[model samples]
Target: MSAPEPAKKPNAAPPVTRPVFLARATYRQRRMRDAAALLPILGALLFALPLLWLGQNGGEARTSHVMIYVFAVWAGLVMLSAVITRILGIGAAPQSASDDAGAADTRRG
Candidate 1:
C-alpha cells in the first residue's frame, strides 16, 4: 500500500469556484438569432400593410392594383430574406471532408 500523503494545511487559501452552465451565444450570434426570429414577423407585417391601407381607403374595383401590390410586397420580402440570409451566411455550402479531399486532389494534379 502507498504511504498516506500529508494533509493540506488549514491556512492554505481555498480554490476558487466557478459556476457550471451551458454554452452561451456570442453577441453576433445573438443578433443573428434575433433577426432570424423577427424576419417572418416583419414579412407578415409587410404583407398586411398594403391590404390594410387599401381596405381602409375603400377603393372601388381596384382588384388589379391590390393584386399587383400584394404580389410585389411578397416578392420584395422574399428577395429581402434572401439578401439577409446571404449576408448572414445562412444556407451556404459547408466545408466538408469530401470537399477538402477534392480540393487537395486538384492541387496535386
Candidate 2:
C-alpha cells in the first residue's frame, strides 16, 4: 500500500490571489457617487456665503479666513452625507423587522 502524505505545517501561509468580480455594480455606485459629488460644492457655497457676509459685517468674532474655509469644508461633508442618506432612502424602512425589534427591546419583563 502507498504511504499517506504527511500533513502540512499549521503556520503555512496561504497564497495571495486577486479577487475577480463576476459582475461589478460599478454603474450604480458611480451614479450615486456622482450625485453625491454635487452636494459638497453647493453646500460650500451655501455655508461660505453667509460666513463671508458675517465677516464683512464684522458680526463674526474669533474666526479667520482659514477658519471660514474649514467650516465650509465641514458643511460640505455634512451636506454630502445628508444627500447620500436621502438618496439611498436610509431611514425609509418599511414597518417590519425594525419595528419588531423595537417592540421586542422595549422594557420586556
Model 2 clash number: 0
Tell me how far the alpha carbon of residue 94 in candidate 2 is from the true structure, in angstroms, after superposition.
2.9
Compute the lDDT of residue 20 as modeled in candidate 1: 73
TM-scores, each model vs. reference: 0.52, 0.38
Each model's lDDT comes to: 0.76, 0.71
lDDT of 2 by residue, 1-109 (tens): 9999999999989999866753356656667778777776776576666445554456664457757777777876887788787766668868888899888889595
- Clash count list over all predictions: 0, 0
Q: Show the lowest summed lDDT stretch of 10 residues, model 1.
A: 52-61
Cα shift from native, residue 19, model 2 (Å): 24
lDDT of 2: 0.71
